[model samples]
Target: MTRALLSAALLLLLLPGAPAQVSSQTSFTIVVSNSVTNAGNKTFSTFVSFRGILLGGMRRLQDKDSGFTFKYTEDDNYGPFLESVNGLAGCPNHRTYWELKVKKPDNKVILPDVGIGCYIPSAGDVVILNFNKY
Candidate 1:
């Protein structure tokens, strides 16, 4: 009985999709858009470690793609506030800011009630950053 139990444990360890064999790398897409619909849009493919923050994935993309760049300011109360994407900066006088939205694998759109620093992106999630006026 002990030999049979040991064989079962070995089989479990060799099977695909076992907890120990799970992948730590996850792939997601980032889309940048303008609410005004005139600035044009861009999409980037990025990946992060399991349960990693969206901001880290964004930084990874920026490092890989020269055309992609972003800037943010730390908020004491709110964490990181997205200030600019590409070369466009949000202007208070213009009443503009960047908005975070996501399209999940289910095709449903969601607005996370949190900042970039707090968002944990899932595999296959399509994160959209839109520059819009308040």
Candidate 2:
């Protein structure tokens, strides 16, 4: 009876539905830059939970680093839209906005179709928030 129970337990553990150990958090870097003003790039390290969105990591960074700050507004159709970084707000009259770009571990830069509220950043990703004009 003991042997049978052990075999059943092992089978259960090996099943596809069984939960496996996984890391709860992922670390990445964030680079803040200003194209219009030519301000030097500031790099920050932050982490988020597994499969967490980029906004979560940004929030975590803001809480930890006094040099980093951000603001966003909710859009009815698009979700959260990044409004400002480091007290620099984008103005429609000035045709300026904050652009989001991500550099992967392989050094490939990608402009995510989704906003920060949706983009799930991978480990080792370099997320760039650039101040630019449209």
Please name the candidate that would achieve the greatest lDDT relative to the true structure: 2
Pairs in steric clash, model 2: none
Q: Put down candidate 2 lDDT per residue, 1-134, tens digits, no spaces.
A: 99999999999889789456567899999999999999999999999889989999999999999999999999999999999999999999999999999999999999999999999999999999999999
State in Å the error of residue 129, model 1. 0.4
Per-residue CA lDDT of model 1 for 7-119, tens digit only, reads: 99999789887344546888999999999656778999998888879999999999999988999999999999999999888999989989999999999999998879989
- TM-scores for candidates 1 onward, in order: 0.81, 0.83
Shift of residue 134 alpha carbon in model 2, Å:
1.0
Clashing pairs in 1: none
For every candidate structure, what is the RMSD over all alpha carbons to the true structure, in angstroms? 5.7, 4.2
The top-ranked prediction according to TM-score is 2
Candidate 2 matches the true fold with a TM-score of 0.83
The lDDT of model 2 is: 0.96
lDDT for each candidate structure = 0.91, 0.96
